[model samples]
Target chain A: MTNAAADTTPAIEAFNLTKVYGSGNTEVVAMKDVSLTVARGEVVALLGPSGAGKSTLLTAIGLINPPTAGRIVIGGQPVMEADHALVDLRAFRRQHLGFIFQKSNLIPFLSAVENVQVALEINDVLPRPARSRAMELLDYLGVADRANNLPDALSGGQQQRVAVARALANEPSLILADEPTAALDSERGRQVMELFRKVAHERGAAVMVVTHDHRSLDVFDRHFEMEDGRLKNGTERNIEQ
Target chain B: MNLATKDIRHNFGRFALTTVGIGLLLMIVMGMGGIYRGLIREATLLVEKIGADLWLVQGSTRGPFAEISRVPANLEDRARAVPGVAGARRFVSHTIQREHRGRPLRMVVQGLSWPEDRGAWIPLVAGRPLRQAHFETIADRSLGLPLGEKLKLGKDVYEVVGLTKGMVGSGGDGLCFFTVSDAVSIQFDVPGEGVRLERQARRARAEGQDIGRLQPLLLERAAGPASGIPALAPPQVSAVMVTLQPGADAAQVAATFATWPDIKVYSTQQQINLLLAGMVDKARRQLGLFRVLLIIISTIIMALIIYTLTLDKIHDIAMLKLMGARNGIIVGLILQQALLIGALGYGLAYWLGTFAFPKFPRLVVIETPDLLSLAAIVLGISVLSSLLGIWKAMSVEPNKVLS
Candidate 1:
């Protein structure tokens, strides 16, 4: 999927984003003046070495951590303009964005399908419709067979697939995944990447994932490499599938 | 956070176990509270149930009926003369051991005189009140008296015509209600054979006659209540039961007795205070201490439980924080869980406390206000204990999950 072929809007934008932890001599700059935009229906992979601020940038854009200085726009809406600083971030995140972590992180008590359904439930969705939506997401992710399996009972790759379905449950325009394939093997990692691409292209969700694994580079529509708190395009971005 | 339902379902075992622990602790708190109420009831049981408003007793006596009170029989008449005094009667209570069915039964013989028809105190719970008042007695049900049995007191036998309930004395003795005259006779009536045999033996020693022959003769000579008896008569009575006249206060009427100077006086309330309430004051205090300690132990245990359960969710909580969940949502989740647990514990406490005491060893009184207050107190404790962990969870950072 090409960014130009996608919807006429930016799915996620971060301008002049900076995250500084601590103060004075002990201050650590996690992200410094970082800016990026991913268009709707495009999947972008953030590539970086360890400690290159890949997670910091991802978290800032994900709204888990507000940037110390800068503005963030999600789904073409200026959600963080420094004016709504006191606004509720958790409710905003629940309504507008989704998250996937290295581990499946599905609540251990609920079944694979219920894990996705709960995300919608927390947003005050009616339980009946919530179940229907959860099942649809699970079916789309190609793991409808294991919907009843708990997190511990499912395979690692299957768990990650369910986690992806959970992220897609609310139909958010942007799905932020951090090291989404870190726990999967090369083959399973490719499958998960392809799923994210499908969600980006078919569901019109702009997907961004932080990955250390280079084996799955062919799956992303765009790629940027982060080094020492800054992002620059890699030769891999120009590489054809 | 999408975690409330998940956290609860995810650890069903831990949740059930925690609920059970809270339930047990709640039961203990309820039991202690019930026992305390029971103590209050035990302290006031006999007096409150005796069905009288004023007690006329000898002056300066205030317990073992309200304070230690013993008054002359004439005090009842004098009490009736006082203004606002409608009626007064005499009641003498004395403890005596008698043989019934080859078993020694210790009984308190209560002498009820005219105008003091306290026989109502012993309702025909088993039989009827003493109809004749001369040869019949009414007794508490616990006395183990049959419907028609003779109660042998000294030389004569008093028939049981009625039985009553809830008339326990301060010393836990069963009361036997008899007529005033009957009680007086029993107080002094000597065993017929024993008195005569002693006298005959003494005379034989002094008369130079054969001991067996003299004994028979003396026994024949002393035939009835009229023979060989000094007849000093039984002690009249120790106290009287007085009722205040309509519209007249018993305390004021009792104050009138101060001028009489012949005897001491006690109002009904004073008698209840001295005899029943005062008798059980020590027990009430002991039970009160027990209740306080149990509540402290339960609260501490409940607090530890809620805290431990909260700690078990540390990892999940950290993850929720990392996933863009707010502190308020986290706090609400923990608090909802805590309060629900508290509510369940309180429900169990109320049911067990209110229904469990009557069947207990001693009567336990569970008042409505006490129940309501305890519920509020337990709920407050639950909220307070949960706050400890809520604060800790609030201080938990999202960075903890990322690592």
Candidate 2:
């Protein structure tokens, strides 16, 4: 990750984000009047049950699905106001945001290293450096030996690690992951969760992970709980909700 | 970083088989064009090689090949006497089927004006032109005749004294060159029974009249054999081939012959046009229709294949968008594969055509300009075909990955 600047502004500040689907009688609120902030150099966990808007809020902050009503500021810049983009959303996403999904979601045709290198290439980085940076990320993630293998050839833990490497390829300020370790065993899941803590502390990237695994709650710097499309509680520093 | 090549490498076997299938289809399309071109070449081959500036045929007829035209052989002398005419030769052509080595053989027998034109202008692959002329023949290789092989045709046996290659008639039969007298004789030669019947009929007519009683010797001579009969004129030729001096105007000389009541005049190019317009026109349209249909089929197959490839990568495309890949990258991935298939298929077609075309009964003449045109056409098809896949890829929402 690029060095974090000495600014005190939070990495992400989302205000009264509301995402509604359909219209009139058929309207459904996926997220309603939700406000949250994730500071740089901190790892936060979003804990909720299914249909509690955890994923909806994650996608909203990731700039993939804009909230129907709200303001989103990332890295001290106003990015979206009520679904109207303040900047080119795709460029902004490439420069400042990263996402990890429930599945590894690596391009099946690309090798582990290429999966990471492609992310850099999408940001217009040259191949040689992209490859070099991909290698460093793979080495840091402890999957360097499996870098040349296709995603199908890697194990669940190894694939998730490669996905993490890819998400970190652009050195973004905010990293959002949705159930990234849901498919792993308890030991592997905790290990992946701890790796997020290391990344947040060492690289100074604000990390937000949506998960139902309360067993790894101690690894996060803070915890936010959601129910019925609203934040039920927000706790600081490894506190149980 | 090229997603197209990476995906192909991952599924090399399936991709290769698909390419081969498309390549074979493209080969047929390319071959159709070659066959049409070959037809044009075959239609104009004799006209171009005969080096005639003008042709004098029977009045109001399209002669020699396109339609039947028979003028007196004496037209050669009249054509030669025209102002600015450098030379004139008798042209006679007719198709005949005869038995050779117990197999039915078809050939277009063309007459060469003797002494003045001894088949010297014909392109020879082996042996010499008709030296003695009466029984010597110059045969095309397509006739399967070997040099020195003598075959009995009609009342005379003609020896294959020379060999030529790629000499085909407008009807797609092999061509054979013979002396004008021999050709005319072969055309009119009758069996012994036919001659006897013809002579008997003539004698019976004479006997029915009062002149038979006073002309018994005339009846006896006429009834003996047709060769002994003195009443018949010489056989007619199909046309008169004329060449002009270097500075002579062919249109002027043709106009002069056009004024003659007994003959029609045509330039060399006009004869070629008549053959193309009459003999080869329908076949050209048929082949052109088939080519267009095959191209359309190939385009549809390519579009479906690309769309399927994109469908297989739907999840990956969504993920790529989620990772901030631009629309250009996704579009490039599909477009590149389509273009690659077209380029590879075209290359395979050209390579296959080299050996396959020669084996066909009719010639397949593939020219350089046609190849270039086909390549451009294939490129256009590739681009058009890929739009389907590109549209599908572009519609994939990044949120789909999150879901």
Instruction: State how far residue A30 of model 1 sits from its true place (Å).
Output: 3.9
Please give the lDDT score at residue A1 for candidate 1. Answer: 35
Candidate 1 per-residue lDDT over residues A69-91, each given as its tens digit: 88998777787763245446767
Residue-by-residue lDDT tens digits, candidate 2, B262-352 = 9998899889989999869999999999989999999999999999999999989998888888999999999999999999999999899
Interface RMSD of each: 3.4, 0.9
TM-score of chain B of 2: 0.96
Q: Model-by-model lDDT, in order? A: 0.73, 0.91
Measured by lDDT, the strongest candidate is 2
Per-residue lDDT over B1-403 for candidate 1, one digit per residue giving the tens place of the 0 to 100 score? 3455566677777776776677677766667666666555544554566555666556456523544455556666777777867776676767788777888898778777843573765556677766675888888776888778888887778888888765655455677888887887787676768767766665555355565355765434434334344442335467655665567766677677667765666555666556435546776677667767866776777677767777777766776665455577678777777777778767766666566655665445667787787788777777787787888788776555566
- Per-residue lDDT of candidate 2, residues A142-194 (tens digit): 99999999998999999999999999999889999999889999999999999
Off by over 4 Å in 1: A1-7, A16-29, A67-71, A76-87, A234-240, B1-13, B63-66, B73-87, B93-118, B131-162, B170-238, B244-256, B270-293, B318-332
The TM-score values for the models, in the order shown, are: 0.79, 0.96
Docking class of 2: medium
